[model samples]
Target chain A: SQTIHQWPATLVQPVGSPLSLECTVEGTSNPNLYWYRQAAGRGLQLLFYSVGIGQISSEVPQNLSASRPQDRQFILSSKKLLLSDSGFYLCAWSVLGGLETQYFGPGTRLLVL
Target chain B: AQTVTQSQPEMSVQEAETVTLSCTYDTSENNYYLFWYKQPPSRQMILVIRQEAYKQQNATENRFSVNFQKAAKSFSLKISDSQLGDTAMYFCALASGTYKYIFGTGTRLKVLA
Candidate 1:
């Protein structure tokens, strides 16, 4: 069985503060990772996706960035947070050849005050 | 680029009744995938069902099923014997050849008990 884990389930930070949200998958290797943000009462916006280590494709150019340090470890970071950056952050993983069925983590609720 | 559309912003249904959520997508690729995801309040987003473009048979999981019309570009989800747990934000997504997914605006379904 595969499981995805995310930390700091709920975060409250002031403006200009740094942000770091971690996501890791167990029981799978070389999996594709993705980062998405969902604003209140809105659809999900894909932010970044990685095929392999050190390879990240950003969908929306914003203050956030993503990094794949290991095969199953992905991190979403931001140097400075904005009020608009507050939302629900979700991390997902899928197999390389299997294009469908993306598993999601519990997610992180970030609030930038 | 592929695009997914969920016209209904919100829908309500009585418990034990049936409800169908509409989804339409636009894609030039023949071989692709369509998925329905559910996001419960204050919980993780999970996959409900998936349909492959190559397959003609619709996908079904327990009480959830999909009506996949490739020619019409419509993939609607039907929930039978709906329960209170069925209340959530439903998202329709399309993935074609790429590793990323294009998500619709989503439909908020409220199942009244």
Candidate 2:
């Protein structure tokens, strides 16, 4: 079975601080990883997606960035966080083609104060 | 580029009753995919059902089913015998070769006793 894991289930950080959220998938290789943010428990805004290591695509221009350092490891980072950056971050994975079922991680809730 | 639209912002139904959430999409690609995802209070995103553009039969999973009309570009989710557990934020997503997903704003559904 495939499992996606995300860390710092809940986070509270002051403004201007650095942000780092990690996501990893087990039981699958060369999966398409994605980063999404949900604000106020509403819609999801896709942040980044990677088809392979060192490849990243951003859907929205904002204070966040993503990197795929390994085949199954994806990281979302920011040098300086903004108040608008506070939201629930989710990691997802799909097969190579990207047009397939997506499995989601537990997610990380970040509160920037 | 593709766009998904969920017309209902919020809806409530009496437990054991039925409810339908509307979703429509716009796409030029011949091969694409559609998905209905549920975000419960726990905040975990779960895939409820999926439909393929090439398939003529609508997809169904237990109590959840989709009314997929490709020509109409409508994919509505119907929940039968709704239960309290059905309360959640529902998202409709469209995906294709781009390796990216265009998600709808979402429809919040609440099952009342």
Candidate 3:
């Protein structure tokens, strides 16, 4: 069985501070990874997705960016955090190629103050 | 471009009752996929059900099922024998032969005990 892990699970960052959220998938290789954000009382907004290592596609350009440094490791980062950047950040993985079901991690709740 | 819509913003159902959450999507592609994801209070996205466009039969997983109308572009999720643990935000998503997934705004479901 495959499992996705994310941390710190919850984060509190001050404005203009750097942000880094990590996601790693166990028992899967070459999986498609995605980054998503959900504001309070809202749905998900896809931020970035990667089909392979060093290949990242931005769905909505904003303060955040994503990188797949390793096959099973994906990281969401920002040089500076904004108040608007506070939300529930989700990391998901799917089978390689298209139209596969995505599995999500426990998620990281970032509160930018 | 593909888009998903969930008409209900919030709903409540008594325990053991059946509730249907409406979802509709727009896509020009003939072959694609639709998915329903559940986000509990923990904000972990759990895949509830999925439907492939090529399959004629609607997909069902235990107490969860989907009404997939390809022509109507409607894909609704039905939760039978709802439980208190079913209280969460349900999101409808569409993947059209790409890495991109468009998600609905989400419907908050409360299974009252």
- Deviating ranges (above 4 Å) for candidate 1: none
TM-score of each: 0.97, 0.97, 0.97
Q: Taking chain A by itself, what TM-score does each prediction score? A: 0.97, 0.98, 0.98
Model 2: lDDT of residue B53: 96
Question: Which runs of model 2 end up more than 4 angstroms from their true locations?
Answer: none
lDDT of 2 by residue, B1-113 (tens): 58899989999999999999999999999999999999998898999999999999999999999999999999999999999999999999998767888889999999999
**Clash pairs of candidate 2?**
none
RMSD of each: 1.0, 1.1, 1.0
Highest DockQ model number:
3
Candidate 1 vs 2: which has more TM-score: 1
Q: What is the TM-score of chain B alone in each candidate?
A: 0.98, 0.98, 0.98
**What local lDDT score does residue B106 receive in model 2, on the 0 to 100 scale?**
92
* Candidate 3 residue pairs in backbone clash: none
Those runs of model 3 whose alpha carbons end farther than 4 Å from true positions after fitting are none
Q: Evaluate every candidate with DockQ and list the scores.
A: 0.75, 0.76, 0.90
Report lDDT (Cα) of residue B47, candidate 2. Answer: 95
CA lDDT for candidate 1: 0.93
Taking the true A–B contacts (Cα pairs closer than 8 Å), what share appears in each candidate? 0.77, 0.74, 0.97
